[model samples]
Target: MDLAEMIKILDRQLTTEGRTIHVDKAKEHMRIEQRTSGQGVSLSLSELLRRYHEDGEEALNQTILAIDRGLHAMASAPHLKGKESKIFPVIRSASFPDHTSDGRRLITSAHTAETKIFYALDLGDACRLIDDQFLDQEGLDEQSLIELASFNLSALPIKIKKDVVKNNTFYFIHTNDGFDASRILNRKLVSDMQAKAHGDLTVAIPHQDVLIFGDVVNPEGYDILAQMTMKFYTSGTIRITMLPFIIEKGKLEPIFIMANKRPMPGKSKR
Candidate 1:
Protein backbone atom coordinates (compact mmCIF):
# COMPACT_ATOMS: atom_id res chain seq x y z
CA MET A 1 0.00 0.00 0.00
CA ASP A 2 1.03 3.60 -0.57
CA LEU A 3 1.44 6.32 2.07
CA ALA A 4 -1.93 7.93 1.39
CA GLU A 5 -3.81 4.65 1.82
CA MET A 6 -1.82 3.83 4.97
CA ILE A 7 -2.58 7.24 6.48
CA LYS A 8 -6.26 6.90 5.72
CA ILE A 9 -6.48 3.49 7.37
CA LEU A 10 -4.55 4.67 10.44
CA ASP A 11 -6.72 7.73 10.76
CA ARG A 12 -9.83 5.60 10.76
CA GLN A 13 -8.35 3.19 13.30
CA LEU A 14 -7.16 5.89 15.71
CA THR A 15 -10.19 8.15 15.36
CA THR A 16 -12.44 5.29 16.36
CA GLU A 17 -10.38 5.12 19.55
CA GLY A 18 -10.89 8.86 20.29
CA ARG A 19 -7.83 10.44 18.70
CA THR A 20 -7.76 13.54 16.48
CA ILE A 21 -5.30 12.98 13.65
CA HIS A 22 -3.79 15.77 11.60
CA VAL A 23 -1.87 14.79 8.49
CA ASP A 24 1.21 16.84 7.64
CA LYS A 25 2.05 15.64 4.18
CA ALA A 26 4.88 18.12 3.87
CA LYS A 27 6.64 16.48 6.80
CA GLU A 28 5.28 12.98 6.08
CA HIS A 29 3.91 12.54 9.61
CA MET A 30 0.66 12.51 11.47
CA ARG A 31 0.08 14.55 14.65
CA ILE A 32 -2.25 12.53 16.85
CA GLU A 33 -3.96 14.16 19.79
CA GLN A 34 -5.96 12.60 22.57
CA ARG A 35 -9.34 14.22 22.34
CA THR A 36 -9.97 14.04 26.07
CA SER A 37 -6.60 15.17 27.45
CA GLY A 38 -4.93 17.03 24.57
CA GLN A 39 -1.75 14.98 24.92
CA GLY A 40 -0.34 14.13 21.49
CA VAL A 41 2.47 12.49 19.52
CA SER A 42 3.93 12.91 16.05
CA LEU A 43 4.01 9.64 14.15
CA SER A 44 6.30 9.47 11.16
CA LEU A 45 4.97 7.43 8.23
CA SER A 46 8.22 7.09 6.28
CA GLU A 47 9.58 4.25 8.35
CA LEU A 48 6.18 2.58 8.54
CA LEU A 49 5.86 2.66 4.80
CA ARG A 50 9.35 1.26 4.43
CA ARG A 51 8.41 -1.59 6.76
CA TYR A 52 5.27 -2.31 4.78
CA HIS A 53 7.38 -2.58 1.65
CA GLU A 54 9.85 -4.99 3.22
CA ASP A 55 7.79 -7.16 5.62
CA GLY A 56 4.23 -6.82 4.26
CA GLU A 57 1.10 -5.69 6.10
CA GLU A 58 1.38 -8.13 8.99
CA ALA A 59 4.54 -6.45 10.20
CA LEU A 60 2.90 -3.06 9.71
CA ASN A 61 -0.04 -4.14 11.82
CA GLN A 62 2.25 -5.26 14.64
CA THR A 63 4.07 -1.93 14.58
CA ILE A 64 0.77 -0.08 14.72
CA LEU A 65 -0.25 -2.13 17.74
CA ALA A 66 2.97 -1.14 19.49
CA ILE A 67 2.29 2.50 18.64
CA ASP A 68 -1.17 2.24 20.11
CA ARG A 69 0.21 0.78 23.33
CA GLY A 70 2.82 3.50 23.48
CA LEU A 71 0.21 6.19 23.05
CA HIS A 72 -1.94 4.76 25.82
CA ALA A 73 1.07 4.50 28.12
CA MET A 74 1.94 8.13 27.48
CA ALA A 75 -1.56 9.24 28.36
CA SER A 76 -1.45 7.45 31.73
CA ALA A 77 2.21 7.32 32.76
CA PRO A 78 2.97 6.87 36.46
CA HIS A 79 4.77 9.04 38.98
CA LEU A 80 8.57 9.08 39.12
CA LYS A 81 9.66 8.89 42.77
CA GLY A 82 9.40 5.13 43.38
CA LYS A 83 10.20 4.21 39.81
CA GLU A 84 13.80 5.37 39.75
CA SER A 85 15.03 2.13 38.29
CA LYS A 86 12.86 2.59 35.20
CA ILE A 87 14.46 5.91 34.37
CA PHE A 88 17.10 5.77 31.63
CA PRO A 89 18.89 7.96 29.12
CA VAL A 90 17.66 7.90 25.51
CA ILE A 91 19.56 9.09 22.48
CA ARG A 92 17.58 11.32 20.12
CA SER A 93 18.30 13.47 17.13
CA ALA A 94 19.54 16.93 18.05
CA SER A 95 16.47 18.28 16.26
CA PHE A 96 14.07 16.65 18.72
CA PRO A 97 11.84 18.98 20.71
CA ASP A 98 13.35 20.68 23.74
CA HIS A 99 9.96 21.52 25.29
CA THR A 100 6.53 20.03 25.58
CA SER A 101 3.53 21.36 23.69
CA ASP A 102 2.60 23.19 26.89
CA GLY A 103 6.07 24.74 27.07
CA ARG A 104 7.65 22.63 29.80
CA ARG A 105 11.33 22.05 29.10
CA LEU A 106 12.50 18.45 28.69
CA ILE A 107 15.38 17.08 30.75
CA THR A 108 18.33 16.68 28.40
CA SER A 109 22.10 16.89 28.14
CA ALA A 110 24.66 17.64 25.45
CA HIS A 111 26.10 14.71 23.53
CA THR A 112 27.37 15.72 20.08
CA ALA A 113 26.44 17.98 17.18
CA GLU A 114 24.24 15.34 15.58
CA THR A 115 22.58 13.97 18.69
CA LYS A 116 21.46 14.78 22.25
CA ILE A 117 20.78 12.71 25.37
CA PHE A 118 17.30 12.84 26.89
CA TYR A 119 16.04 11.12 30.01
CA ALA A 120 12.88 9.02 29.99
CA LEU A 121 10.87 6.81 32.27
CA ASP A 122 10.41 3.36 30.75
CA LEU A 123 6.79 2.20 30.74
CA GLY A 124 7.32 -1.38 29.53
CA ASP A 125 5.79 -1.06 26.03
CA ALA A 126 6.72 2.60 25.83
CA CYS A 127 8.45 5.51 27.59
CA ARG A 128 7.71 9.10 28.45
CA LEU A 129 10.36 11.79 28.27
CA ILE A 130 10.92 13.41 31.64
CA ASP A 131 10.07 17.08 31.65
CA ASP A 132 10.93 19.92 34.03
CA GLN A 133 7.57 19.62 35.79
CA PHE A 134 8.09 15.92 36.39
CA LEU A 135 11.49 16.58 37.94
CA ASP A 136 10.02 19.26 40.18
CA GLN A 137 7.25 16.95 41.37
CA GLU A 138 9.84 14.26 42.21
CA GLY A 139 12.11 16.80 43.96
CA LEU A 140 15.07 15.43 42.05
CA ASP A 141 18.02 17.49 40.87
CA GLU A 142 19.38 17.11 37.35
CA GLN A 143 22.74 15.70 38.40
CA SER A 144 21.13 13.06 40.61
CA LEU A 145 18.74 12.13 37.83
CA ILE A 146 21.57 11.75 35.35
CA GLU A 147 23.52 9.66 37.82
CA LEU A 148 20.57 7.37 38.42
CA ALA A 149 19.79 7.04 34.73
CA SER A 150 23.41 6.32 33.89
CA PHE A 151 23.55 3.68 36.59
CA ASN A 152 20.41 2.06 35.23
CA LEU A 153 21.81 2.13 31.72
CA SER A 154 25.03 0.45 32.81
CA ALA A 155 23.14 -2.26 34.63
CA LEU A 156 21.52 -3.55 31.41
CA PRO A 157 23.07 -6.54 29.64
CA ILE A 158 25.43 -6.01 26.71
CA LYS A 159 24.96 -8.11 23.57
CA ILE A 160 27.04 -7.87 20.42
CA LYS A 161 27.06 -9.48 16.98
CA LYS A 162 30.18 -9.28 14.87
CA ASP A 163 30.54 -8.94 11.07
CA VAL A 164 33.43 -8.28 8.74
CA VAL A 165 33.79 -6.54 5.38
CA LYS A 166 37.03 -6.34 3.39
CA ASN A 167 39.14 -7.24 6.43
CA ASN A 168 37.51 -4.58 8.67
CA THR A 169 35.48 -5.71 11.68
CA PHE A 170 32.16 -4.27 12.77
CA TYR A 171 30.38 -4.88 16.08
CA PHE A 172 26.65 -4.29 16.33
CA ILE A 173 24.42 -3.91 19.38
CA HIS A 174 20.79 -4.48 18.45
CA THR A 175 18.95 -5.86 21.44
CA ASN A 176 15.64 -4.48 20.05
CA ASP A 177 14.88 -3.32 23.61
CA GLY A 178 14.50 0.36 22.59
CA PHE A 179 17.71 1.26 24.43
CA ASP A 180 20.25 -0.10 21.99
CA ALA A 181 21.53 3.33 21.01
CA SER A 182 21.38 4.53 24.59
CA ARG A 183 24.03 1.90 25.36
CA ILE A 184 26.49 4.38 23.90
CA LEU A 185 26.33 6.09 27.29
CA ASN A 186 27.84 2.99 28.90
CA ARG A 187 31.45 4.13 29.16
CA LYS A 188 32.86 0.72 30.03
CA LEU A 189 31.46 -0.85 26.86
CA VAL A 190 33.00 1.73 24.58
CA SER A 191 36.27 1.62 26.50
CA ASP A 192 36.43 -2.14 26.14
CA MET A 193 35.81 -1.88 22.38
CA GLN A 194 38.51 0.76 22.08
CA ALA A 195 40.98 -1.44 23.91
CA LYS A 196 40.39 -4.26 21.45
CA ALA A 197 40.40 -2.19 18.26
CA HIS A 198 43.16 -2.99 15.79
CA GLY A 199 42.91 0.52 14.38
CA ASP A 200 40.74 3.61 14.89
CA LEU A 201 37.57 2.98 16.88
CA THR A 202 34.48 4.41 15.24
CA VAL A 203 30.87 4.45 16.50
CA ALA A 204 27.55 4.99 14.76
CA ILE A 205 24.05 5.25 16.17
CA PRO A 206 22.08 5.71 12.95
CA HIS A 207 18.86 5.14 14.85
CA GLN A 208 17.43 4.30 18.26
CA ASP A 209 17.54 0.53 17.83
CA VAL A 210 21.09 0.05 16.50
CA LEU A 211 24.59 0.85 17.63
CA ILE A 212 27.54 0.12 15.32
CA PHE A 213 31.23 -0.04 16.21
CA GLY A 214 33.81 -0.15 13.46
CA ASP A 215 37.41 -1.25 13.66
CA VAL A 216 38.73 0.79 10.77
CA VAL A 217 42.11 -0.13 9.29
CA ASN A 218 41.72 1.04 5.71
CA PRO A 219 40.02 3.91 3.82
CA GLU A 220 37.55 1.49 2.24
CA GLY A 221 36.19 0.67 5.70
CA TYR A 222 35.01 4.24 6.19
CA ASP A 223 33.21 4.17 2.85
CA ILE A 224 31.41 0.95 3.75
CA LEU A 225 30.45 2.29 7.18
CA ALA A 226 29.11 5.49 5.63
CA GLN A 227 26.87 3.59 3.21
CA MET A 228 25.68 1.24 5.93
CA THR A 229 24.90 4.10 8.31
CA MET A 230 22.96 6.02 5.68
CA LYS A 231 20.81 2.99 4.93
CA PHE A 232 19.87 2.50 8.58
CA TYR A 233 19.35 6.20 9.22
CA THR A 234 16.93 6.56 6.34
CA SER A 235 14.88 3.53 7.32
CA GLY A 236 14.92 4.06 11.08
CA THR A 237 11.76 4.77 13.02
CA ILE A 238 13.65 7.14 15.28
CA ARG A 239 16.79 8.23 13.51
CA ILE A 240 19.70 9.65 15.51
CA THR A 241 22.41 10.57 13.02
CA MET A 242 23.89 9.49 9.72
CA LEU A 243 27.33 10.72 10.71
CA PRO A 244 29.61 8.45 12.70
CA PHE A 245 31.94 9.38 15.56
CA ILE A 246 35.52 8.59 16.48
CA ILE A 247 35.81 7.61 20.15
CA GLU A 248 39.05 9.00 21.51
CA LYS A 249 39.94 9.21 25.21
CA GLY A 250 36.21 8.91 26.14
CA LYS A 251 35.21 11.85 23.94
CA LEU A 252 33.03 11.45 20.84
CA GLU A 253 33.99 13.55 17.86
CA PRO A 254 31.76 13.49 14.76
CA ILE A 255 33.46 12.71 11.48
CA PHE A 256 32.78 13.43 7.81
CA ILE A 257 33.41 10.63 5.33
CA MET A 258 34.04 11.15 1.62
CA ALA A 259 33.80 8.23 -0.78
CA ASN A 260 37.56 7.70 -1.30
CA LYS A 261 39.18 10.23 1.04
CA ARG A 262 40.04 10.07 4.74
CA PRO A 263 37.32 10.75 7.30
CA MET A 264 37.86 14.11 9.01
CA PRO A 265 36.65 15.04 12.47
CA GLY A 266 34.15 17.84 12.50
CA LYS A 267 34.34 20.59 15.12
CA SER A 268 32.72 19.63 18.38
CA LYS A 269 29.50 21.49 19.11
CA ARG A 270 29.10 20.22 22.66
Candidate 2:
Protein backbone atom coordinates (compact mmCIF):
# COMPACT_ATOMS: atom_id res chain seq x y z
CA MET A 1 0.00 0.00 0.00
CA ASP A 2 1.06 3.62 -0.52
CA LEU A 3 1.90 6.11 2.23
CA ALA A 4 -1.36 7.99 1.68
CA GLU A 5 -3.44 4.86 2.11
CA MET A 6 -1.46 3.85 5.19
CA ILE A 7 -1.94 7.25 6.75
CA LYS A 8 -5.66 7.17 6.01
CA ILE A 9 -6.01 3.79 7.66
CA LEU A 10 -4.00 4.87 10.68
CA ASP A 11 -6.06 8.02 11.04
CA ARG A 12 -9.28 6.04 10.88
CA GLN A 13 -8.13 3.46 13.41
CA LEU A 14 -6.81 6.03 15.88
CA THR A 15 -9.86 8.25 15.49
CA THR A 16 -12.12 5.26 16.00
CA GLU A 17 -10.42 4.78 19.33
CA GLY A 18 -11.25 8.43 20.25
CA ARG A 19 -7.84 9.94 19.57
CA THR A 20 -7.56 13.57 18.48
CA ILE A 21 -5.32 13.36 15.41
CA HIS A 22 -4.12 16.23 13.24
CA VAL A 23 -2.67 14.97 9.96
CA ASP A 24 0.10 16.87 8.22
CA LYS A 25 0.31 15.49 4.72
CA ALA A 26 3.16 17.70 3.66
CA LYS A 27 5.34 16.63 6.57
CA GLU A 28 4.09 13.05 6.42
CA HIS A 29 3.37 12.85 10.17
CA MET A 30 0.40 13.25 12.44
CA ARG A 31 -0.03 14.92 15.82
CA ILE A 32 -1.95 12.79 18.30
CA GLU A 33 -3.44 14.85 21.09
CA GLN A 34 -4.45 13.39 24.41
CA ARG A 35 -8.10 13.77 25.19
CA THR A 36 -7.81 15.00 28.77
CA SER A 37 -4.17 15.93 29.32
CA GLY A 38 -3.64 18.35 26.43
CA GLN A 39 -0.19 16.77 25.88
CA GLY A 40 0.35 15.13 22.54
CA VAL A 41 2.87 13.19 20.47
CA SER A 42 3.95 13.61 16.88
CA LEU A 43 3.78 10.26 15.04
CA SER A 44 6.10 9.98 12.07
CA LEU A 45 4.71 7.89 9.19
CA SER A 46 7.94 7.37 7.25
CA GLU A 47 9.11 4.42 9.32
CA LEU A 48 5.65 2.88 9.39
CA LEU A 49 5.41 3.17 5.63
CA ARG A 50 8.80 1.57 5.25
CA ARG A 51 7.75 -1.29 7.50
CA TYR A 52 4.61 -1.84 5.48
CA HIS A 53 6.62 -2.09 2.28
CA GLU A 54 9.12 -4.49 3.77
CA ASP A 55 7.09 -6.64 6.14
CA GLY A 56 3.50 -6.38 4.88
CA GLU A 57 0.21 -5.82 6.73
CA GLU A 58 0.84 -7.94 9.81
CA ALA A 59 3.93 -5.94 10.64
CA LEU A 60 2.00 -2.72 10.11
CA ASN A 61 -0.78 -3.92 12.36
CA GLN A 62 1.67 -4.91 15.10
CA THR A 63 3.36 -1.52 14.91
CA ILE A 64 0.05 0.34 15.15
CA LEU A 65 -1.00 -1.82 18.09
CA ALA A 66 2.30 -1.13 19.82
CA ILE A 67 1.76 2.58 19.23
CA ASP A 68 -1.68 2.38 20.76
CA ARG A 69 -0.36 0.53 23.81
CA GLY A 70 2.55 2.96 24.12
CA LEU A 71 0.24 5.94 23.98
CA HIS A 72 -2.01 4.54 26.63
CA ALA A 73 0.96 3.75 28.85
CA MET A 74 2.39 7.22 28.33
CA ALA A 75 -0.90 8.91 29.13
CA SER A 76 -1.14 7.02 32.40
CA ALA A 77 2.55 6.69 33.33
CA PRO A 78 3.33 7.03 36.99
CA HIS A 79 5.15 9.96 38.51
CA LEU A 80 8.93 9.77 38.13
CA LYS A 81 9.80 10.96 41.60
CA GLY A 82 9.96 7.44 43.01
CA LYS A 83 10.89 5.51 39.90
CA GLU A 84 14.64 5.97 39.87
CA SER A 85 15.33 2.27 39.37
CA LYS A 86 13.12 2.15 36.29
CA ILE A 87 15.08 4.88 34.52
CA PHE A 88 17.60 3.80 31.88
CA PRO A 89 19.58 5.32 29.05
CA VAL A 90 18.43 4.85 25.47
CA ILE A 91 20.55 5.39 22.37
CA ARG A 92 18.73 7.27 19.65
CA SER A 93 19.73 8.75 16.32
CA ALA A 94 21.25 12.20 16.57
CA SER A 95 18.33 13.48 14.52
CA PHE A 96 15.81 12.40 17.13
CA PRO A 97 13.95 15.33 18.65
CA ASP A 98 15.85 17.25 21.30
CA HIS A 99 12.70 18.53 22.91
CA THR A 100 9.17 17.37 23.55
CA SER A 101 6.09 18.61 21.70
CA ASP A 102 5.45 20.92 24.67
CA GLY A 103 8.93 22.45 24.33
CA ARG A 104 10.50 20.81 27.36
CA ARG A 105 14.11 19.89 26.57
CA LEU A 106 14.76 16.15 26.67
CA ILE A 107 17.46 14.89 28.99
CA THR A 108 20.24 13.76 26.66
CA SER A 109 23.98 13.27 26.65
CA ALA A 110 26.43 13.26 23.77
CA HIS A 111 27.48 9.83 22.52
CA THR A 112 28.88 9.85 18.99
CA ALA A 113 28.27 12.33 16.18
CA GLU A 114 25.70 9.95 14.72
CA THR A 115 23.95 9.02 17.96
CA LYS A 116 22.83 10.56 21.28
CA ILE A 117 22.02 9.08 24.67
CA PHE A 118 18.60 9.87 26.09
CA TYR A 119 17.17 8.70 29.40
CA ALA A 120 13.75 7.13 29.62
CA LEU A 121 11.53 5.71 32.32
CA ASP A 122 10.62 2.11 31.52
CA LEU A 123 6.92 1.72 31.94
CA GLY A 124 6.16 -1.99 31.07
CA ASP A 125 4.52 -1.56 27.68
CA ALA A 126 6.36 1.66 26.77
CA CYS A 127 8.96 4.14 27.84
CA ARG A 128 8.72 7.90 28.28
CA LEU A 129 11.78 10.02 27.65
CA ILE A 130 12.79 12.12 30.60
CA ASP A 131 12.37 15.84 30.05
CA ASP A 132 13.61 18.94 31.88
CA GLN A 133 10.29 19.42 33.63
CA PHE A 134 10.31 15.87 34.94
CA LEU A 135 13.84 16.26 36.24
CA ASP A 136 12.92 19.42 38.03
CA GLN A 137 9.81 17.87 39.49
CA GLU A 138 11.84 14.91 40.73
CA GLY A 139 14.49 17.25 42.16
CA LEU A 140 17.15 15.11 40.53
CA ASP A 141 20.31 16.43 38.96
CA GLU A 142 21.67 15.21 35.65
CA GLN A 143 24.70 13.50 37.11
CA SER A 144 22.57 11.51 39.54
CA LEU A 145 20.18 10.63 36.77
CA ILE A 146 23.00 9.45 34.54
CA GLU A 147 24.47 7.39 37.32
CA LEU A 148 21.18 5.69 38.03
CA ALA A 149 20.54 5.06 34.40
CA SER A 150 24.00 3.67 33.77
CA PHE A 151 23.72 1.43 36.78
CA ASN A 152 20.39 0.09 35.62
CA LEU A 153 21.70 -0.36 32.11
CA SER A 154 24.59 -2.44 33.38
CA ALA A 155 22.21 -4.70 35.25
CA LEU A 156 20.21 -5.71 32.19
CA PRO A 157 20.84 -9.17 30.71
CA ILE A 158 22.28 -9.72 27.25
CA LYS A 159 22.40 -12.79 24.98
CA ILE A 160 24.81 -12.67 22.07
CA LYS A 161 24.73 -14.69 18.86
CA LYS A 162 27.83 -15.15 16.76
CA ASP A 163 27.82 -15.14 12.97
CA VAL A 164 30.59 -15.57 10.40
CA VAL A 165 30.84 -13.75 7.09
CA LYS A 166 33.86 -14.05 4.81
CA ASN A 167 36.08 -15.39 7.61
CA ASN A 168 35.20 -12.46 9.90
CA THR A 169 33.18 -13.05 13.05
CA PHE A 170 30.29 -10.79 13.96
CA TYR A 171 28.55 -10.71 17.33
CA PHE A 172 24.91 -9.69 17.42
CA ILE A 173 22.70 -8.71 20.35
CA HIS A 174 18.99 -8.56 19.58
CA THR A 175 16.97 -9.63 22.62
CA ASN A 176 13.99 -7.46 21.59
CA ASP A 177 13.98 -6.22 25.18
CA GLY A 178 13.58 -2.64 23.87
CA PHE A 179 17.15 -1.89 24.97
CA ASP A 180 19.10 -3.88 22.45
CA ALA A 181 20.78 -0.82 20.96
CA SER A 182 21.18 0.65 24.41
CA ARG A 183 23.48 -2.26 25.22
CA ILE A 184 26.25 -0.40 23.40
CA LEU A 185 26.47 1.79 26.48
CA ASN A 186 27.24 -1.24 28.65
CA ARG A 187 30.93 -0.77 29.32
CA LYS A 188 31.44 -4.22 30.78
CA LEU A 189 29.83 -5.87 27.77
CA VAL A 190 31.88 -3.87 25.28
CA SER A 191 35.02 -4.62 27.28
CA ASP A 192 34.20 -8.30 27.15
CA MET A 193 33.73 -8.14 23.39
CA GLN A 194 37.04 -6.33 23.11
CA ALA A 195 38.81 -9.27 24.72
CA LYS A 196 37.28 -11.57 22.08
CA ALA A 197 38.15 -9.45 19.02
CA HIS A 198 40.54 -10.97 16.49
CA GLY A 199 41.22 -7.47 15.20
CA ASP A 200 39.68 -4.05 15.78
CA LEU A 201 36.40 -4.37 17.69
CA THR A 202 33.82 -2.71 15.47
CA VAL A 203 30.35 -1.74 16.72
CA ALA A 204 27.20 -0.83 14.85
CA ILE A 205 23.78 0.04 16.16
CA PRO A 206 21.86 0.07 12.87
CA HIS A 207 18.59 0.52 14.66
CA GLN A 208 16.97 0.45 18.08
CA ASP A 209 16.64 -3.31 18.09
CA VAL A 210 20.06 -4.55 16.94
CA LEU A 211 23.66 -4.11 18.03
CA ILE A 212 26.43 -5.52 15.88
CA PHE A 213 30.05 -6.17 16.78
CA GLY A 214 32.54 -6.99 14.06
CA ASP A 215 36.00 -8.46 14.27
CA VAL A 216 37.68 -6.64 11.43
CA VAL A 217 40.62 -8.77 10.31
CA ASN A 218 40.73 -7.72 6.67
CA PRO A 219 39.67 -4.86 4.38
CA GLU A 220 36.85 -7.05 3.09
CA GLY A 221 35.47 -7.23 6.63
CA TYR A 222 34.90 -3.49 6.61
CA ASP A 223 33.11 -3.70 3.30
CA ILE A 224 30.95 -6.54 4.53
CA LEU A 225 30.10 -4.70 7.73
CA ALA A 226 29.22 -1.57 5.82
CA GLN A 227 26.87 -3.48 3.56
CA MET A 228 25.24 -5.27 6.49
CA THR A 229 24.85 -2.06 8.49
CA MET A 230 23.31 -0.16 5.59
CA LYS A 231 20.86 -2.96 4.90
CA PHE A 232 19.76 -3.08 8.54
CA TYR A 233 19.61 0.72 8.83
CA THR A 234 17.39 1.06 5.80
CA SER A 235 15.02 -1.72 6.89
CA GLY A 236 15.01 -0.85 10.59
CA THR A 237 11.87 0.37 12.30
CA ILE A 238 13.84 2.97 14.27
CA ARG A 239 17.15 3.76 12.68
CA ILE A 240 20.24 4.75 14.65
CA THR A 241 23.08 5.09 12.15
CA MET A 242 24.62 3.48 9.10
CA LEU A 243 28.10 4.50 10.23
CA PRO A 244 29.90 2.07 12.53
CA PHE A 245 32.27 2.70 15.41
CA ILE A 246 35.50 1.10 16.60
CA ILE A 247 36.22 0.75 20.29
CA GLU A 248 39.68 2.21 20.90
CA LYS A 249 41.05 2.39 24.43
CA GLY A 250 37.58 2.24 25.92
CA LYS A 251 36.24 4.95 23.61
CA LEU A 252 33.86 4.78 20.65
CA GLU A 253 35.39 6.31 17.55
CA PRO A 254 33.27 6.56 14.41
CA ILE A 255 34.82 5.04 11.28
CA PHE A 256 34.41 5.54 7.56
CA ILE A 257 34.19 2.23 5.69
CA MET A 258 35.14 1.95 2.03
CA ALA A 259 34.62 -1.01 -0.25
CA ASN A 260 38.30 -1.91 -0.79
CA LYS A 261 40.21 0.40 1.55
CA ARG A 262 40.70 -0.31 5.23
CA PRO A 263 38.20 1.43 7.50
CA MET A 264 39.68 4.43 9.29
CA PRO A 265 38.37 6.10 12.42
CA GLY A 266 37.22 9.61 11.67
CA LYS A 267 37.62 12.67 13.85
CA SER A 268 34.60 13.67 15.88
CA LYS A 269 32.59 16.53 14.40
CA ARG A 270 31.16 17.31 17.81
Displacement of residue 150 (Cα, Å) in model 1 is 0.6
User: Which tens-of-lDDT digit does each residue in 171-211 have in candidate 1?
Assistant: 99999888999999999999899899887788999999999
lDDT of each: 0.86, 0.83
lDDT of candidate 2 over 1-270, digit per residue (tens): 888898888887766354688888888888777777656667778877877787788867866776776678657747877788899999999999998766899999999889999999998778888988888888899999999999999999899999898778899999877899999999999889988777878899998889999887777788888989998887666679999998887788888886455777632211
Model 1: lDDT of residue 15: 68
Runs in model 2 with CA error above 4 Å? 16-18, 35-38, 44-47, 266-270
Where's the lowest-lDDT run of ten residues in candidate 2? 261-270
Tell me how many residue pairs clash in candidate 1: 0
**lDDT at 220, model 2:** 75
